[model samples]
Target: MDTTQTGLPVRRGPRPRATTTNPHVQLDQNAPAELQDRLRDHALSLPGVRRGVSTVSVPGTVAFFLDTPTERPAVPDILGGEWGHIHPHTDGSLHLHVPSTLADDLIAAGWAEYHSLVSRGILPPIVIMLYGPRDEAELAVCSSIVEEAYLAAGGSRVDRAGRTLGLPTP
Candidate 1:
């Protein structure tokens, strides 16, 4: 397994190819249905997150957004509500707005690539598509990545175990 400079291990095998990142779909190496379900469940389970149909993504994509206002939402305007969403296609990939530095790291680590809109200057580079987890280990890594997105949203600080340390007192 190839690990990133930050120690996030990239999944084994060829990097999944993208047929069109604008619609944000993958061409091959899609995760199986079970893994896809598990990944989506894990992402939706993050603190302050809620699931709904994506207003920003392609039709049928399930969206994850902060249900409550964050103390300091970093990218609060993502499609007016969503901060991330899971694609409905077979690849099961997801697009999310994370911290810019982390986004660069994720791309460098081969875990993700910038959204097509970023290239055209329509969206900031913070938007990325984290490839779907291919197995158990990748699932864990992807979960961690989602947690980072949660943090970037100013949801709350959390431990590596995903426990809320407590929200800041207003």
Candidate 2:
């Protein structure tokens, strides 16, 4: 795992694999239902965030979107203000749009990977698959990651640990 002084710590294990077709689910190392609920609640609690079905993911996932988006979003052209979504009771993985630079760091740190469509140019590089949190410690990191994604989506909130990320301009 790699680290950047002011970025997310390297997640503690190998990257999890995600399916390549419809549904695009995580294949292993899923989070428990309780932790998934906690993470969902945390994302929804961000300022201006709202819960809804994902516009870009399979049905049954819960998505987080801003009620009002910033003028310039880090990832543009998302449907219905959608910024991120979680596979709650299923794989528990999440899909989000983050600042491009942060997406690279997240991959380098083993916390996430670019969404498959990004490589095919169907999606921008900002779109990523954030791996699920398997324990309390991992949940803390996942939560912070989700917050960063939220900020990138035009929502405002203070940094959790005084850790300033390269947040997308609002």
**Estimated TM-score for each candidate:** 0.85, 0.86
Model 2 misplaced regions, further than 4 Å: 70-72, 159-170
What's the lDDT of the predicted structure labeled candidate 2? 0.80
**Model 1 reaches what TM-score against the true structure?**
0.85
Over 4 Å off in model 1, which ranges? Answer: 159-170
Cα lDDT computed for each candidate against the true fold: 0.76, 0.80
TM-score of 2: 0.86
Expressed as tens digits, the lDDT of each residue in 1-170 for candidate 2 is 34565555778877777888656788888889899999999888776778898877776899887878644466674666888899857789999989898898888888898887887888889989999999998888898889888878876655445554433332
> What pairs collide in candidate 2?
none
Candidate 1 lDDT at 90 equals 67
Q: Tell me the deviation in Å of residue 30 in model 2.
A: 0.6
